[model samples]
Target: MHEIPVPPAEATAAVPRLQRLYEHRHPALSPVLAWGTDQSGVWVAVEPNEGTPLGSILSRGPLTPPAAAAIGAAVLSGVAALHEAGIALGGFGATAVRVTTNGDIRLAGHPAAAVRAAPSQSDLRADVRSCGMAVCAAFGVDPAGAPAPPNISPGLVVTMRSMASGAMGPSADRAQAALREMAAALLSPDREMAAQSELATRAGGRELPPITPFLPEGTVAPKPTAPTPAPYIAPTPRQETPVRSPVSYDAPDRPLQTYPSMPAITFPPTPVPAPAPPPPAPAAPATPAPSVPTWSDAPPRPSAPVEPEARATNPPAPPTWTPMEAPLPAPAEPSKAAEPEAPKPAPTFETAAPASPFATFPPAAPPPAEAPAPSAPPAQQTWTPVEAPVWKPGETVPAEPLGTGVAVVETPPKAPTPAPIPRAPIAAPARRPSVARPPSRRGPLSERPPWLLPAAVAVAIVILLGIFGVIVLANRGGGQVTGGVHTTPTARASTSPAASSPSPSATTKGPLAVPNFGPTSADPISKVQICTTASPCNIPGGSPENGTACDLSSCKIEVAIYFSSVQKSAQVSYTIKFFDRCTGQTTDLPGPSASTPASGYIVSIPTDHWTVSIPNGVKSGAIVAVASKPAVARSEPLLLGADSCA
Candidate 1:
């Protein structure tokens, strides 16, 4: 056999153990020889003969009768051997049997032992059923392949089929019966017993080895032959009898009998035949043609009596009966036959009255006139006369003339113009006494009086002024003043009180000392700022002549005030001005006293040492020192008296 590749690690490990077990159990059979794990866990065994499996042979179609019977007998024998060894060939199928070239057959890869070891009974029976299937498949028949022999009941065949189909219950009896039936059929008289015997001999020693496991017990070989003969023959036309008035036939001597019910035969009476001398018996009773078994001319005789010898010699004939043909009636025309009449339409009613009831009412009178006549205009007007006029006290009216039979009423004529009512001119109507209005009770004014705001402002100003005056008075004596003060009076007062106190003040005095200032050095000073808030007299380089009152405090130096020396090509002059804090004015003490034209200042003092003081009254603000570099100093003023400093 060609070598199959070694399987994966797990399969490789399991193969040796399985091989050992298989070899141990099936010593008579060829060793597994070699095996390889397939994708499924099942091992593929390589045997010496390189033959196709029985399944493949059968799959090609029905086998020749000889080969089929031979293979079936061999398979049954193999299964019977396995059953004897208590090994169930689980998963058995035609595929499990292999046919060698020599025509010998062997069962391969029996699974019965494994199935028996399974925990479930269902699984065990499943294995047996599978073996039964293999037998059925090998025989090219169903699990119920043929009607079982008489000794094997039909119920047993049904049970076997059910088992093969995975129905409930153990099928040991069923499978045994089925196997026996197959074996019997194959070995029956009609079969070639010689061929089967030869095949069996060829396959005898080749049966599956006695493995460790097996199917369930009660594995019996099929009976040598059915214990009883079939009572009835298969029905056929030739076996039927001619009709002779309904009658029954009985086999008195046989163990079983069947009688067919026959219909009366009514033959048209034959013309009476003339009597003739008896004829000698014929050599053999003429056999009737299968189609025309009964003839009218045949002489009627009494039923034939059975002879003991004939009964013992011949097999019983199967009963049959002629089928009667009934004639069909003719069809009738549907149109000639009476049909149910169509239902009549329901009746409708009409009223005797006119169709429309409202047609007779008289037409409505023409719509009433919408507007009244215009003749009586006043009447048409909706307004009515006022009932009475208001009267004046003394005015008189003229009377109407005595009516001409018409009663006329007259108003009195104005009293003769009373001579210009000379009396003191009628005082103009006493001015209606001016009605006195009670003083208005409206609430206080809604908006604040304008004067009130000014008053409040004045009061606030006064309060602020008082506070300011007190602050000034208190600060005059240096009572912890905050924020720089510019007035000289305040400064002097603050200083004088501290100086004159009986106890020497702890305050430091003299040329004011600047703290936290040092010359720049290689280590790089972090920052250079002088604290001059406490002292106003000290300037880094300012001469005392500049003025003791010069207000030199809190000054910063301009390191490069004159840049000309650094720039050798030009002559320039720079002036720095200092202002007095107490005077609110500025004075240039030393710088640019006059424009001395030069390229630069060359002196030992580091230019960074030059300091400009901030004056006392100059808003107590910071002093800004600047460095100026010019191309040249002006030889003459471009505009006379135009301060170059400005």
Candidate 2:
């Protein structure tokens, strides 16, 4: 075991207090480790790993709205729990709460015993005030040094400033109200004014006035007093006795006189002698001799007579002075005193000074109290045997070889075994045969039946006759038939005498006259002009002279002729003939010609009072229009014109 050196006494003394603080539980509060103590007389510590101190997180700054509300709710709930536990945080502020990184907010610090043991309404109010201060601080308000509560409303700004001042009074009330507002602002889902009407009543403080015109009230004053003097006194002998005595001296003149009469003389004694005789007769002879008494003079004494009248008037001077010297009486014989004996025993116990008020004594042992009996251990064994092999004393166990090997072992039998069983078989089936029958019949055959014979005889006769007729017809007039049948010579002669007679002659017309031939005239027509004149012409006089003219003389003779019109009905048949002058060859156009009536043809005449324009790029060739007439001949062709028909 290692020994740790002991800490200094002061450091050691703090450990138990810190431990007690750690163990102490606040309702709804997690136990925190007291890391250290701070100069402000506060316990500095971190919240539990799972818990957060609300104050520390809020002190960093105002939280986001929802976060702030959540934290506020948690703080209020924690406060309520503390209140339920009869605990009140004596000092509540942002510094007194902390937030864990996990976002749990918790109240920190140990509450006062008064709060923890049995909290009062006032104690709770105080806690409210502290909480209010914390909330105000969160809003960046410095609660301390705020204006007097009467001047400032219980609002966030006022409370924060008030808390900054670190005093608890009207400012604390303001802070409390601010806390109520903070609770509403942050925690209340529906922001609302706090339930402060009951708070003033419960707190029993002066009711705060409204924020308008001030109200005043009457009050009374107190009384006053006067002054007095002190008295004086002289010193007294009895009063001076406690002080030490001063030294004194005796007179040396006339040897010390003794007087026993003085009461218990405190000082040494003094002595003196009796008076001398009177001078005689110095009064009677005064006139003559005046004598002064010498130091050794022996003057006689005169006796004075006594008169009865003088006696009443004046008394005579009487008798001589005696010079008796009494030796100083021997000091009144010194009184005898008893000798001192052995001293008495001193006291064993000394009286002590009065006991001091602050002194402490060892505490007395308290009387023994009854203690609970310890419970007995349960009978059921719960101890599990360790799996490790136990080494037995005096047993030499051989070490197993360090390699893998399969171990097989055989042991004695305990019980026995049995046998088996069997089963059964199966089956099969059978068969049969068929039958037959005959074919069907027909109807009765026919005999000569009715007209059969006659028909046959007739057929024979007809055949014979047909053969005879064929032979007769074959022999007749070159196989000709007279009337309906073939005839023999005699039959034919009988059937027609006319066939054998000769026919009469008839009249005949002469051969049909040939139509007259007429001479044709050809006329030149300008290329740009219509042909209007020709001998015996068939052209109309008003027609435009655009094409050449070929005229056959008109005789007005009719002839049977066939005419082939180039156009039949509405369709036109056209043919073009090409003469390639360079080749000196004339050829029919490969494509067919188109034909229309002469009246329908629009011939372009260059001059006839108005010019008829020919189409551009018409090949410089002659064009002919022909019509066929069928009356004169089987096929006749009519000519419209000819163009350089060389």
Candidate 3:
């Protein structure tokens, strides 16, 4: 029972009529068990709700569309129930919707119309709008404003918007029908369900502050239009600069002149360079000549291309050499008198070397006297071939200059020749110095004494004996439930109604039931599942009429009540009561009496799998199972109803 605050003496006058109108059995509108006015407020007694409130849930996050739809469908049903009974619900808010532990819904804040005897059109519409606000709120919308929640499915939004607008049809029945259509739209077969489902997941996920996307108004991010292309502007013409000819002191801009070529460079034969390479036979010589050692300190640069008229020979294969006039012998070690010889103003003995034999451009002009020349390399050092690359047949091997007259040729290596001779036995030298060899690894325990095996066997025998002793001790400590339900993937529900007694014609009574509520599961969250509005109704004797309630006596319940057994012994006080399925009122099953199903030995249920057959006089209702103190956990109400559909 929660205090429903009433304002003044006038407000107190309405409490009696409110209770009279509300305290009766109804499926969706929870009946007020009792009501009384006090200085604090009007306290209305109803069944205790173990489930969370819609207001509390909304605080966590807007519910998913499916959840909102489901919750909305239920809340609307309750609201529709009230409107049908001709009472206008007042002081209602998201808090007025109660969700029970067993997933049952109830419209709780029952009050009279402002005018007492007759409800005005505006009052009915107010109730309608409240229901609409509730559904919207469940869908994560703010009902105070009129912006449609963008996160809501467009298909669902239309109906919810109309309902929230209070013009969703003049009556609660029409609003109920519209909400039903919205629920139906949530089904798989509906053409728009796919899009709605996808939208529901993201509904109201994106929110912004004032005039937020999560309000009654629709949520819609502005569509980003493609940016207009910038107008094309002709590229501005770049300034052109004239090319200046570089001044040259070594090969000048004159007619071609002949000069003696340097000798080809060679490397000393070493293992014939591993099968010495094939010559340049039928091979296209490399375009770039290996750089020759320079006499001048200037960095090497490309000289002008040599005309065919200046070449002594033009081999059909590619040119692999460049002929340049050699430097004036270096004065046999740069004699002091020769060191300062006047710098040439034009061509001289030193010609700018070309990087490739085929280059067409001449080297640029040398820097002026202000620029310092690079120091010459060490005289003692010589360049040597580091490694020889294995050459395949038809591959080129360039011939290069070594000095003024010499040249190097790469000839293919000759196949090794054999020389035959008489054979003779060679004597082996006396055994060299003795070398130690590593010892081989031995198998585990192989190197141990023979007694080691017997010791290991004795240890193993002792361990087995100790384990056997412990098993014997555990059984002696206390009794364990050996008749644990043998659960598989499915529990065979007994849907048959219970019989009064076995008929003479019936030789066997229904197989003695060892109730298996469901499959063996591993949920460490530690929750107790008693029953609820959605629990399956397995009448014990036979299948029942589909749309009608089953006999109250035929229904018995077996709950798959799992709570951590760790605290079972400490949880000493408990209450087990029946909550009427229709009225939402609880009746305590008096303890320790043969008249009732509960036994005195324990006022509380002690184990998982608590079973109870309905007593002689009790009608259809749900069971409220609670284990007090050491753990304050309650079972979802185990419902007794017509069938599983109930």
Candidate 4:
């Protein structure tokens, strides 16, 4: 085992990846087992193998084409499997290929190094190149530096080169398949020849069709067929031949024919024919033809081309001096000349593209809206200058300036009032001695000393105690223990239930200490009927379904009740009833209103399944089903929750 130390964070991240890739165990690929990490590095346990690397194998001797292909095929198989699982082995090379003692090529590499969370097309193609390099190395060529392996099938060489050079498709699936097929074909030349010979014998022998190499599955090239098999004829009885083991092919005896190699060729895809152009719908307004640009120098209302005679009769005015005229809005007469509208044609396939159901014509505005046309030439109107009249001071023009902020004229000063005669000094009344009054303590309690509040509280408590004592003496005596020493009862201690409590039928509010009615309250049995028809909702055999909730939009409750087979013949009656907490009286619930949009009903569904709804505004109530006779068996009542739609 070799150890590669990575950052603790990187190792932590790669643990999951290595652990996942560990499941791909193949004789063609060594597995990596993660033993986890430590302060030193991430630990990976790999299978120990005696086989030498591809580089070592090449160092020993060059391998034959079949040998190279066999190794390449095995490695490609492992690569393809990993690729399918979304794992790509980066840094793949000759060192990654291990030749076992039994002559198997297993791929070996640091899977951690190739742990990419987001493998992409480039990564896959790089894997394909790695396979090609393995092939090159097996053929005794330096994969890192070689363009193509020497002395292998030229066709095979080209395939390998294309992959290594990134000329193949983005994925390795096709290349992987091609390598497997070639390896198989090369491994059994004898079987192939035997099959071909038998085929040839079966052929009538007019001439055998040229054999095209098998392409990858789904490749669509030209299809070719063989000559028809020998025609059926009356024949003698035949005996079955004995089975025989395949013989190992000898190289020298037949010097296997220089069989042409099959290259994987994926033909170009067939093109889809374009749909026919649409027919012009007559409803399509005759807008300016597309050949003419909308914004052109040519006038919208073009002048007819002047004839030579007309030009000679009236020498044309300077074209540049002619003032441009804005298009005038046509006068609206009651439209007596309006053409009869054409019937719209039914849209056909040809017109579907151009005819839009949403298309609408602009609303018609009458000629009264020709304000722009009249005002367009208003800027051209000529106005004559007029003289202004002069004004004399104190006449038409006032003395003051135009602005209000300024006082251009002065006003006469007002006469001062005569100084008031000096009045005799009025003497202030003699001050009387203020009577010394004690301060009244009228102030907020906050202003007083803090001890005052505590004292007042103590007094109030003493007064309450005296009142309680007086009441005890005046009426029944206090039930105090003789010792006057009593321990306070803790909440956790048990208490005796009331001597008498009303049964559920009593419906009395206070009689039964109603089991604490809030969350920590005991579970109350609120029965809901599981029936279809009110008359037989819980009937032993009726297949009535609970109608949908009265208002499913707000709240809904679905329920199902099952009864014993023995009770199938019985009929049941159901009604809703509510316990009015405020009224302290139980009231039979009224049927859901027809005016209510919801179809709220409490009934058994399909004989056994039942549903009961409690929509908003429906009184929180108990839905009861009374059996016609004594029922042999009955389903436990299901509770319809208040807060939710079930």
Candidate 5:
């Protein structure tokens, strides 16, 4: 059971009257279960609370327009009911309302009978203002100081604010009707779903704070304390083992071997080399060329006529001529008149001169015993094998020198009985110099003109551009949605409600539900915006910024209406209305009628606008949209700045 204590000052008069009031049942109230008085004061018990408190729900976060409207509507209904019964709540706020689990609204916080009886506490207009303030509080708006939230409808915002500031006059019915309409439109399935998604995107979510009772001034609630953790205890340390020293030992002894550096070998100085002999002067042709001696230092040739050898049937090649072996020539004795020349060393293969085509040599002789060592010491020398000299045609053979103890032939060799004819050297066929020619151009990937590369690049770029154009055309012609705009390139049949309506048998059971539109989607109507000369509103491309301050002379309103899935391919007609709270007046403007294609589209209304004005003492205003045909629908109040409108 729920319980409330009656103040001591009114306990006597209130206890009896409250009993009679509770005798009957009311939809806006809970039945009084029992009544009595205890040591604290007079008390009344009612049914147990079945739902969350509006205050607790507000603690979690601000409510959406629909949610706040639902609560506000229920609050007013209860207030209106109580007024009919000639009763009034002394104090009404967020805490005084409770929403049941089954979506029913119940009034709690019943006041003392004496308090309700007082005329000062029974003003109905004041109660209506309190309801508006409660709604503003649910939206996290301070009715007296903060601007209205944008999610609310303009009409509803103006109505609520007017009621809150006592500008609604004495009629509470107007405020209640406005809230009911807002709740009906905003509570639709599609609208509710969209609101939930938007709410989820919000950052920094809040949770309800701890619920507590109101305490008298000077009294404070006690705070909770946490338990301390146990003190840390360290583990015992382990004992360390003793380290052992390394063992000492002696290494084996061995004798070391060493050698003195060897002395460099020395040799006797070589004698100065004699200059080469100059070429012999050509002899007179009359003397038969004196039989050109083979050796430069050989004895003069003999003056005898030698027989020539018979030529064979086929003479051998000139380079293949074999020379007959003859005895070596003896060395000439040193001349007494000339300085003695140093003995010449015999030629080895490495030191021998290349054989000439006109030179010849005799067979090698046996090497003689080494001559007795001279009294002077000799230099070290290297010896190598000797090679026989090559024989050539029409050349005389020369002999090698024989050392002492070997025999040498002093007499010149006699010519053979038959001398072979010598053949002249054959001349080779000469090659003509190659003729120069230009470079060949026949190959793969031949050279191209300088402009070929750039021309090919241009062609490729054109092809890419053509492909891009095709893609863009496809998107435009195929009824695709881009960004948040919908495009229809081709004409489609109109399906307005005036042209076609669903039969009764085909009608759906519930109201038309609004669907959640994606970022790239269009809703039936966009949020309203307030405009002035300083910040003129523009649509279809730009959105106007809403503000509380405006220039009255150039003030206007702007909004966009889009065809949703249910309204696609139909002609929709809508109206824009302005509610001035200060003057308690409303003005309606004819909006455009648009034929939406299958792909849907958005249209901003009232291409032309006029000045706006408000009374001197008002502080709030709103804009609202109402659509007829294709199912009647309304939008949440769009609260605008009151600086100029007021």
Candidate 6:
């Protein structure tokens, strides 16, 4: 495996190299396990480095001198191993090296070493020189012969210059061993601590300066003077909560809980005074006595309140009352003259005896009043005789008498007028026979000739014929009315003599009237093409192109309609259907019908493209498109390809 640092412009070329490297492996090279292309482009799976990137360390203005020496030693060690294996890295740099927290180096970035290619002299030299560059970079110095910083030891500086110049000898083992010695010397415990402290200080003083002892050993620190006492402030008293006592069921051996003392509460010695008694109720009022209903002639009296009578020591008895009844007339003495009529009793009231039948008036009002006088009976009806009708010499008299003349003529009683009675029909008297009368003479104007009827009939016929002609001519003048469309008559551009005179054959069809409109043409949809591909159906290689056939399990179907001209910007809707010839069934395309108000050219639809699945069947089917707007129009159906069953 290898790391190919392809430049931004040359990224496409790295894929081939990555593929080649996956075929071989080497210790100094990280391995690529797999590589593939996705929608996001090329990707490679390589072993991940579990170390701190050397580049990250160097990015922060280089490492300490000792750390630079350690990195240099590890890089050389890896290169020496490569040299022993007779292979060299294609390139090496800060990016190609990684250092673990434990200070071990990992080598990478050789696409060539991944394939185990033989190393060239120049390649070997380049690896060693790259190692030197890494060392110089770690020391924060230029690898182009610039003087090393004064802090780096002279021996380590010489080693950096030799490796950078590619003069470190044929084998890196010698340089690697010398670098180990320099790193150990520079990385001593005391020096390392000093370097870290210096670095931390340069990065913003995270390390504290050495602290001085509180006092010198021979002398005593002056006894800390007692801090001057702050002015006295009284502390606030805290409220103490009382502890709750334990329940009686607690273990007998347990100690009893004690509570804080509470202040005493005092109560008055005397009991509170009793509430005052309620006030007495007021006396009830006396009730008015009930009054009797009187006749209309009687005057109404004002009412007065009656005082209740004092109760007696003994229980009082209920008083008796007399119902005022009409007095009966005395009966006539018996025919024997022996029995006498019983006397009538007079009416009485609870308060007093009444002298008349109306005596029981309201006790609260006036006393009894006299009864009204009785009205006289209606006078009887009297009869006045009606005179008999005088008889004529030839008049006939009925055998029945005129309904008991006496009763019929009786005077009506003195009451409302009665309804009039319907009179019965009476027979007329017979009359003598009379002589025949002469006929009246006719006038000259009233006289009619025998030919009058036929002449009248002929005139009526002539009037009817004129009306029929007018109706026929009016109908012919209007333009023909076909399907609901209305076509107004258009004036001809120029009328030729032939157009002016109607043809003899036209006369046979109907009464010849002036023509009202010009000839018309067909519907707007002139061409329709349906196919499986999204491309124009007229184009070559489009699946089941116009007039072709289709045979597939599933396919995207698009429709293209062409029109030569439009009557208006009419809203047009399209529906596609599949006709299954095998089952004689027609199914609508499974999507919303497409509609558009645009016209005058090809209009493709559905904004969302759709596809249809052809069900397995015995044989052929047909696809049809119907435009249902502006005007109903249909396309010639196209057949599915040769029958699958066949």
Q: Over the full model, what C-alpha lDDT does candidate 5 score relative to the true structure? A: 0.48
TM-score of every model versus the real structure: 0.22, 0.19, 0.26, 0.27, 0.28, 0.25
Model 5, range 1-646, lDDT digits (tens) per residue? 4344655655655555566546755665655677765555666767776355667666655655655555676677766555544455644777677766554556776534323343221254567777788767755566665676555556666667776776553234556766777557765665444433333322123321233232222222223244589999998988989765544554455555554678999999999999999656443333221122222222323355534433222212223222222223233333432444334344322223334442245434444557797565553322111222232223432343221112233448887788778999899989887998988777767877899999999999999999999999985676433442122111224566333222223233322212111122224444333344454454332344233243333344443343343333465555655544334334555554534333223333322232344333334445555665343455544455443331
- Which stretches of model 6 miss by more than 4 angstroms? 1-46, 50-52, 101-103, 187-646
Please write out the lDDT profile of model 1 over residues 35-99, one tens digit for every residue: 55576444445555634576665554433334454554555455444443334445466566776
347-440: candidate 2 lDDT, tens digit per residue = 2333444433422553334445569899665443211111112322222223222111222223358566554445454444343344444433
Q: Please, what is the whole-model Cα lDDT of each candidate in the order they appear?
A: 0.38, 0.34, 0.47, 0.45, 0.48, 0.51
Worst 10-residue stretch by lDDT in candidate 1?
634-643
Task: Please give the lDDT score at residue 466 for candidate 5.
Answer: 100
Root-mean-square deviation of every model: 56.8, 71.0, 28.4, 45.4, 26.6, 36.8
- Mind giving the per-residue lDDT tens digits that candidate 3 earns over 1-646? 6565656674566655665555555666666666677776566666665345667656644544555676677666766555555456642677777665444556766642421433333455577777788888877665555566565666577777777876563356666667777566443333233323323333323322323233222223223346689999999999999876666645565544565678999988676446767554333234423332333222233354633332222123322344332222222232344344344233234334443453345333443446777977754412211111232223322333232221223346898888878688798888988788877598775688889899999999999999998998885765343332111111255455442222112242222212232223233214544432355323222221122222356533333234333221232333455544332234555311111011111112222223354545433455555544434455655445443212
Q: Answer with 1 or 6, whichever has the higher lDDT.
A: 6
- RMSD (Cα, Å) of model 4: 45.4
lDDT of 6 by residue, 343-451 (tens): 3244454653432332243223324556988976654322111111232222222222211122112234779878999898897988877866765487777879899
Scored by lDDT, model 3 comes in at 0.47
Measured by lDDT, the strongest candidate is: 6
